[model samples]
Target chain A: MSQKIEFENILRRIEEISENSKKIYGAPLIIDPKTGVATWYDQREIKIRFLISIEKIKRFFEALSRGKILATKCVNTGEIMFPPQINCPRDPKNQIEWVEIPNEGELVTWTIIKVKPYSFSHHDDYIVGIAKISNLNINILAWVKCKDPNKLRPGLRVRLNIVKREPENYLIYQLEPLEEC
Target chain B: MRRKVAIVGTGHSIYGVRNDVNLPELAYESIKEAVDEAKIGLDDIDLVVVGNVGGWSSEYLPAIVINEYADLAGKSTFRIEAACATGSAAIKTAVDAIASGEADIALVVGVEKMNESLTPVVVEFIGRSGNYFWEFQNFGLTFPGYYALYATYYMFNYGVKEEDLCLIAVKNHHYASMNPKAHFQRKITVDECMKSRYIAWPLKLYDSCPISDGSASIILASEEIATKITDTPIWIEAIGSASDTSNITRRKDFTGLYAARKAASEAYKKARLDPGEITRHLDLAEVHDCFTIAEIMAYEDLGFAKRGEGVKLIREGQTYIGGLIPVNLSGGLKAKGHPIAATGVGMAVEIARQLWNKIERGRQAPIKNGRGLAHNVGGTGHYAYVTIYSLTKPRG
Candidate 1:
C-alpha cells in the first residue's frame, strides 16, 4: 500500500471518530486514551499540485515517445547538455541542436533507496545510477534494474533503454548492464 | 575591496528534536544569549539577516515572525536561503552590509524546527531540493541516495571500506558524548555502525545526519565597533564561496565536492595560508560532516590529506583531538545534529567559542596560532562556504 494512503486512512479514522463523538456528546473534542489529554482535531485540509512548464524542451518528451534519447548540443562550442536544454550557455547567441545520445555508456556509481520520500511512497525500493555516455559528453541519471547493488562495479559498460514503467504505463529510461552479470 | 567584519558575539541552541519550543521561541533562545554576550540590545542592531529553509515547518515568513517576537520589528530584515548553507549565506549577507557601511552592527540568526513535521514529510522536502523535476520527480532520489552515489564511487575507485566510513561516525559520536547540547550524546562502536540497517546501499543509517531542530545566532560588528565590544572577537578572516551544478550527474567527479575544493582554495588565498599546509596553520576545524563520506572528502578538499588519503587519516585516528588538527570537536552535524539552516551558523559559533578558549575541557582543541576553519556545504555540493576565523586581525 502507498504510504500516503496509509497515513490518509489513519487521519480519516480520527475524523470519523470525532464526528461520531460530536453527534453523541455535542462537542468536537476527544480525550486521549493514553495521556487523558483533551484535544481538538483540526478539520481543514490542504491539497497542492504544481503546474510546471516544459514548453521550452517539449521535443525531449516527443522524442522519448518515439524511443529516442535526445540531448541538446551547443552549435558553437559543440558542448552537449543532457536533461536537454533550450539555450546554449556558452554562446547565448548561438542556437542549440538536438542530438541523439549513444545507447552505450559506462556505469559510474549507483545507490538503492530503501527509505523513500512521501511523494515516492507508491514505488517499491528502486536503484538509481549515473552512467557516462561518451557520445553525449555527459552523465545520465536513470533507474538501474539490477538484482543486487553488490554486483554493480564502477567502469562497467552499460546501455540506456526505453521501457514502460510497471503499474503506470508511462515510458521512462533505464540502464542495463552491458557486461555479463 | 571593502572594510572588514568580525563575529563579536555568538549563540547556539541545543540541537535535537526540539518539540517543546515553537519557531520564534526557539529563535529567541539564541538571540537573547547573543545579545547578552554582545552587551547590546535591539536598539543597537542596524540590520537583521535570518537564515531559514521553511517547507517542513509551519512558519513561512520566519524573518518577520522572529523580528516581531524579538521586539526588532521596525528594523530592516531579510531572509536568506541556500539549502543547508543558509546560515553561512546569512552571515555573508550581513558581512556585506557591514563592509558596505550600510550597517555597523548586524544580527545573523539561523533557525529551523524540522521536528514539527513527520519524518517522511521532511525527507520529501529535502529530496526535492535538487533538480526536482529532472532528478527527483521521476527518479525519486532521497538525500542519502545522492550521497550514496559518492560513497559507492569513492569506495569502488579509492578502495575505501565501509568500516572506514564507520570510523567517522564513531569519532564524531565520541566527541558528541561530551557535548551537552548534542542530540545523540552516546558514542557508538565501529561494530554498531556497521551493523546498522542501510538507508541507502553502502550508506548505513549511522552514516547519515538526522533531521534536527535547533537555532544558532552570531552578532557581526564592523572592524571599529568590534574591538570595543569584546576583548576576544573572532575576526571573519576570509570567506570563500562557490557552487556546483544542481543535478548530480553534471559533476565531473564523485570522490570529492568540486565546489568545496574551489571555495577552500579561494579562502586559503584570501587568508594568506597555503592550502597544502592548512592543518599546520590552524588549531582546529569544523567541517560539514552531513555524512561520513562528506567528512572524508572535506579532509581532502580542505587539504588536510591528499586525494584518496583522507580515509587513511580517519583510519589512523588523526582527526581526533590532540591528533593533527582536531575536527568536529562540537560533535559536528553527525552527532551534534544538522538542523539544516542552523548548521553553518552552528559551525561558526563552535569555531568562535574554540578561539575564545571558552569551550568545555576534553573536547576543546588547544588554541595555537590563534586560527580556525569552518567548511560548510549546502545541498550535495550545490553551495560551499569556507570561512577562516582568527584571533589576529586580517591585514587586508
Candidate 2:
C-alpha cells in the first residue's frame, strides 16, 4: 500500500481505539498488530515543511526558468561551483559570478530508485544519476530519463535537458543519454 | 597530559522491532546492564554521553529524557549525532572526557527507535541526510539508492558481479546465526540473497541493513579506576575520525569512501600499526556493513586489501573466521541490525566481547593479537570513525 493510504488506515484505527479507550482508560491507548505490545498513541499530529531562503542565489533559479543551468564561479580563484554558492572561501576579496553549465556530459554513476521515500512513493520508480559535465571539474546530480537502466553505464554520453516535473510542476534539469558514445 | 581510558563495561539489547518499550525504557535496558556489569551505580558515573540521531523518533532531547529515567538526573549529560556514526561519536566523546581528566568515569549510550515511525517516514528521514536541497529534494534518492550509485561505479570499474555482493550478505548472516542478540539469527544462502527483491538497482533487500530499534551501552573509566572495576578492561588504543562533503556529487571517487581511508590511516599512525599488513595485527573487525557494497569498500579503505582487490577477498572467502581476517563476527550491521546511532557502540561492545572471549563460541575469533577494530561510517561516507580496541595497554 502507498504510505498515504497506509497512514490514513492507521490513523482511522487509532481514532477508533481512542474513542473506546478514552471512555474506559481515559487515554489514547493502542496495541501493536505485529507484537501485540501496548502503546500510548500520541494525540497531537504535526506537519513540518522548511522555508529555505535562496535570496543570495535567486539568479540560479531565474536562469533555470529561462532554459539555462547556472553555476557560481569565483572570479579571482577561477573556481567553479555547481549547486552554486555566492561566496568563495579561498580568498576574502573574491567575488562570485554566475556561469552556465555545459549541455553535454558523460554518465559517472546512476541508480534506479526502486524503493523511494514516502514523499516520492506516489511516483513510479525513477533513476537518479550523477554525470560529469564536459570540460568541467564539477559534477551534477539529477534524474536520468531512461527507458532501460540496464543499458546505462558509466562513461555513456548524455546531454542536459530542462523540463517541468509534473504533479509538483517546477523546472528541473535532467540527463538524456545520447544514442552514440 | 593525556591519560589512558578503558572500557570497563559493555551492554547490548536484543536488536529487532522492539515495540514493547518506549524510548527511555529501551535505553534504560542497556544502561542498567552496563552499570551492573561495571559494578557501579548511577552515582559512580561522572558524565553521560548519549548518541541518537532523532528525526523519526519522538524524543527531541533524548539524553535528558533517558538520563532522567535511569535515575541519572542532574548529571553532566549531552547527546551527539553524526548520522549513523553517532554511536562511535558518543564513545569518542566519553573517551575524550576521561582522557582529559574531565571525568574519571563516564557512560556512553547509543540508542535509536527507528521503528517508532512508519518505515516510509523513516526512509524519508534518512534519505534527507545528505545535501537535501541538491540531491534528495530534486531526485528523491533513498539511502539504498545513494549506496547503489557507488555499487554501480565500483562494479563497472572492478568487474564485480552481483553474486560477489551476495557473498557478503551470506557471510554476515552465517555469523549472525550464532549471535543471540542479532536481529537476523538464521543463516542465509547466496541463492537466498540473490532471490531477494531489490530495494535499489544492484542493492537487494538482503544487501541492506534493517531499520532496527535497539540500544547499546559502554562504561569508560580512567586507567586507575578501570583496573579496579574490571580485570579484563578493553583499552581504547586509538580512535580516528574524519568527514567528507555532504554532497555526493562532489566526491573525488565513488569506488570507496575517501574519509574512511584518511581515518584508517590516522588510526594506524596513532596505534603505531602498519596499514599494509593491518589484518595480521588485529584479531577481527566489525565494519559498518550497512550495505554489502559498504563492507567491500571498507576492506580497501581500511587497507585490508589493495584498490579493486576487495572483491577478490570476498570471493576467496578470506574474510571468514580462520581466514586472513574474520570480519563482522557479531553479524555486522547487515545481519546484527543497524539502530542508527546505536550501531557504533554496538560495534565497540562486540569487539570488546570478542577480545575477552565472552561471545558465543561459533562466531568468536581466536584472539591471538589481543586486538580488534571497529570501522563506523555515517550517511554514505559523510562521516567516518575508526576505533581500535586492545587487551594490552598502549605504551604511548
Candidate 3:
C-alpha cells in the first residue's frame, strides 16, 4: 500500500479516457470518478527544464564532481556562504574565496517525504533535511540517508558526502548520520 | 498626509474543489456581490488589483481575463503575486495607490483555480515555489514537507505531541462546519486527523489545506468616497509586511517566522497597540493556517502566546470563542480551502465580516472593541502581511 505509481501514469490514463470521450462526445472532457465532476482535459503539456547560469560560482559544481563540498567565504568580513556564491552581500567590493565545506555537521532539522512531487514519486519515501556545519558556519539542504526515521533527530551528528543520484545519475551532496544509532 | 481607507464592500465565493466554474466565472461570483454591496457601479472604481498565483490554471493572464470578462477592461489594472499572500499583497498595492492619492477607490480580487490540473500536477507546481533550483530541483520539497520541517523542530523544542497539532485542525473544522462558504463544512475529529496518512511526516493529509478553487474580492475607498459609499465601513487600521530568506537553509532558525514577528510588531506599532495586550484591543483574529503547525507558529508570531507556549493555547482551547481570542471563525485555510492567492483576501473578507457581526450564527466573534486582525503568510515564511481591520475610523 505504501508503494505508489508515477503520477504521469495516472495522467496518461486520464488522457486516454479524454481521447475516447473526445471522439464520442465532441469535446475533451472526463468525469471525476469521485465527485462525478466534468473537467476539460487540456490538450497541451509543458515540460520545464531551467538553464540556470552558474558561471560566477562554477567552482562549486567542479568541487562536487570531485566529491568535495565547497562554500564561499568573504575575505574581508569572514562571512561564509554555503551553496556558494561569488559576491559578498554586505560589501559588494569584498572578494570571495571558494573553500571546502567541512564534511562533519549537526543535523538541525529533517522530514520524511511521504508524499513527494510528481517528479520525485518514483523514489521510495526519502528524508530531506538541513545540516549545520559549525566549523564551516554554513547550513546545507539535501537528501538525508537513513534506514530508520526515528534516528534522524535534530542535533544529531552527520557527515556530508557527494554521490551520484540514482535514475538520473547526477552528482549531488547528501547528509548521512555519522554513526547509526 | 495619507488619506484613510476603509473596506466598503466585500465578497467571497463558496470555497471547495470547485470544478464547476471557470476562472472568470468564479471571480465574477464574488465581484458581482462586492459591486452590488458597495452600491457602486464598476465605472466608479479608479483601479483594480487582481491577486493570483497562477501556474496550474489555464489562463496565462488572469487579471486581464477577469477584467475583460467583468466589463472593466479599460480600467487601470495589474496583477500581483506574493506566493500565498498574493491577496494581501494586492490589497496593500491598492491601499498604497489610494494613500498616495493615486486613486480614490480600488477593487482587489484574489482568485485561484488550482483544481484545473490534477492533484499531482498541482503539488508539483506549488512544490517548486521556493528556491526552485537549490530546493525543489534537488531536494524535492513539497509545501507540506517544508512546514513539516518547522513542525519537527517545534515539536522537539516544545515537547508537543502530534495530537496537539491535530487539535488546531479539529477546532478549525468545527468552525468550518458552520461557515457556508468554507471548503470542508463537515467537522472533523482528532481521531480522524490522527488516522489520516502523512503527506509529509509530522504533517498529515488533514493537517494540510486542500487544493481549492475560489475567489474573494474587497472594495476599498478613501475617506472622502468611503463616507458616501457605506455606513458600516471596515477601516484599514494598520498593515505591516515583511519577507524571509528564500532558501530554508538560509533562514536564521525554524522555531517561528521572524518575518511574521517583525510584521506584527510594525502593525502593532502603527495601530498604537501592544502585542502583549492584543486581545484587549481586538475582538478576534484570522491567522494563516495553511497547515496546522503553521497556525501554532502564528500564535507565537502574532504574540498571542509566548515562545514554546502556542501549543498550550490549542491544548486548552484558548483560541476558541469566549477564550483568549477566537481564531479562524471562517474555518480558516485549514477547512475554508486555501486557493493560494485567494486565501489572504479571504482572510480580509472574514475579518471584515466578523467585525461587522455578519458571520454565521455559531461562529461569529463577539465584536466588543469593533476590531479584528488578519495574519496572512506567504509560502513558508517567504512573505508576511499583518492587517488590522476596525469599525471606527482611524485617526488622521
Candidate 4:
C-alpha cells in the first residue's frame, strides 16, 4: 500500500509541474506534498561525471584486473603511496615506481553502515574497514567481508584480497580475516 | 607586530528547521542585531567575512547575497569554508584582517539554510564531505556511520555501554529544554534515546545532532576600538587551528580526533596553559558535540578528562554546573541545533555572552577564571579550531 501510494504521488507531482513548464526559466515551482510548502525547485540540473585522467597510474587498474593491489614507491625517499599518485610531494623530481601491496595486514578500525546515502541506497548494510599494511607504512580502506563486528578487533590479523565485485563484476579490493573461522 | 582583536558585539538567531524565513532575511536577523549591539552603522564596517557551506542551500554565493541584503555591498567581503568549522575560519580571517591594521572593525557572519534541500539530499551532501571519491563513492557511508566507527571502537575499548552515550543526549536535551532558541527544546530521557532507532550500529537517532538552518554574527574590533566600544569586551586571547589528512583511511585511530588534539594543544600553548591541565584554567567550554560520541571524545581531546575516561565524566555528572569544568551550557550542537557553518560562530556568540554574564539563570557557568573555550571541528576531524575567549586583555 505504501509503495503504491508513493509511486502515484511521485508520478502525479512530476506531471503536474512539467506540464506547465514550456522551457526552463531557471525556476521550477513545486509544492511539497508532505508539508504543502511552496518550494522553487532548481530547474538547472547538474550532472557531474568526471573524466578522471588515470593515464599516469594506468598500471594500478591493470594490476587490479589481474587480482593485485599496487602502490607507488618514491625512488629517492623510498616512501610508499597508496591510492597511487604520479608525483611524489616529498621529492618532486625523484623517480617513482609502482609496487604491489603486501596482502598481510592488521585491521585498525571497522564500521557497519546501517544508514546509506542517496547514491548508495540500493546496497545492503556493508562493513567498511581500514587495515594497516606494515611494510607500506600506511592504511588502506576497503569493504571487509565479515559477518559479525563482535569478532573484529583493532589488532586482528587480516589480508587484502583483490576480487570481482558481484552485480557489477568490477575489480575491487576487500579485507578478509586471516584467522580460521 | 600584529594588534590584538576582541569580540565587541555578538548576535545569534533562533536555531531550528527555519522554514519561515528566507536565506537573506535569516542572515539579516543576526547582522542587524550585531550592528545594533556594536553601536555601529553600515559605514563603520570595513570588511565582511561570511561562512557558509552552500551545497544544501539555494544561494550559491551567499556572501554577496547577504551583503547586498544587509546593504553592506561594494565593501570588501569574501566567503570562507572549512566544513562545519567555517564560522571559526571566517572569524580567524576577519581577525587577521583587523590585526594587520587593514580593517579596524570587521563583521563575521555564519549562516546555513540546510532545510532548503530535502533530508535525503542533505544526508548525501554531508556524507560526501570526507574524501568523496575514496569514502562515500564506494561504501556509501552516512554521517552517522562515520561517527559510529568511533562509537563502536570506544564502547568496545572502554567497556562503556550504549546507555552511557544516551546519557549525553539526555543532558544536552535537558539544557535545551531551558533554551528557548534550541531546536529540540523538549527534554528527553535515556530510555527514550535508547528506544530511538539505530541510524548506525551503536549510534541511535538521538546520538546525532539535527540538520538545522540558522545564522549567527559577531562584530570583531581591534583592541583600541574594542575598549572604546564596550567595557566588557570579550578578547580573542588565542586561536589555534590545524588540519588532518583528507582520507579517513590515512588516520592512525578512530577513537579520537587527532586534529582536535593538535588544535587544543596549540591553543593552550598560546594561552600559556598546559594542555594536560586546561580544566584548571578554564571556567567552561562549548566543544563541538555534533554527535554524542564526538562530545565524549572532545572531553578527552580538550583535556577535560583522561583518555578513555570521558564516559566516566558523563556518567558521574562531572560536566554539569557544579562539576570540575562545565561544558555545553548552551545545549551544544547536539540539542542547540547544528546549522553546520553557523555552529562555530554561534559558539563564539554564546561564549561571549557567557563571559559578559548575559546568559539565562540556570545555564550560566560561573565566570571565576574569566576564561572560556570553544572547540569546533570541521568534517570528521579534517579541520579543527580551538578559540579562547577571555574577560581580561591578553598580555604579550
Best by TM-score: 3
Which stretches of model 3 miss by more than 4 angstroms? A1-6, A33-36
Task: In angstroms, give how far residue B106 of model 1 lies from its true place.
Answer: 0.6
Model 4: lDDT to the true structure? 0.87
Q: Which ten residues in a row are the worst by lDDT in model 2 chain B?
A: B114-123
Candidate 2 residue A170 Cα shift, in angstroms, is 0.9
Tens-digit lDDT track of model 2 for A1-181: 7645776687688789878888888888776667688877777789888999999999999999999999999999998898899889996896988899989999999988877788897788889999998677989999999998878989999999999998899999999999732
How high is the TM-score of chain A in model 2? Answer: 0.90
Ten contiguous residues minimizing lDDT sum, candidate 1 chain B: B115-124
Looking at model 4, give its docking quality level. Answer: medium
TM-score of 4: 0.93
User: How good is chain A of candidate 1, measured by TM-score?
Assistant: 0.81
Pick the lDDT winner: 2
Candidate 3, DockQ score (0 to 1): 0.81
- Please write out the lDDT profile of model 2 over residues B202-238, one tens digit for every residue: 8999999999999999999999999998888999999
Off by over 4 Å in 1: A1-43, A179-181
DockQ, all models: 0.63, 0.83, 0.81, 0.52
With a 3 Å backbone cut-off (N, CA, C), the pairs that clash in candidate 3 are none
Q: Sort the candidates on DockQ, descending order.
A: 2, 3, 1, 4
RMSD of each: 2.6, 1.6, 1.3, 3.0
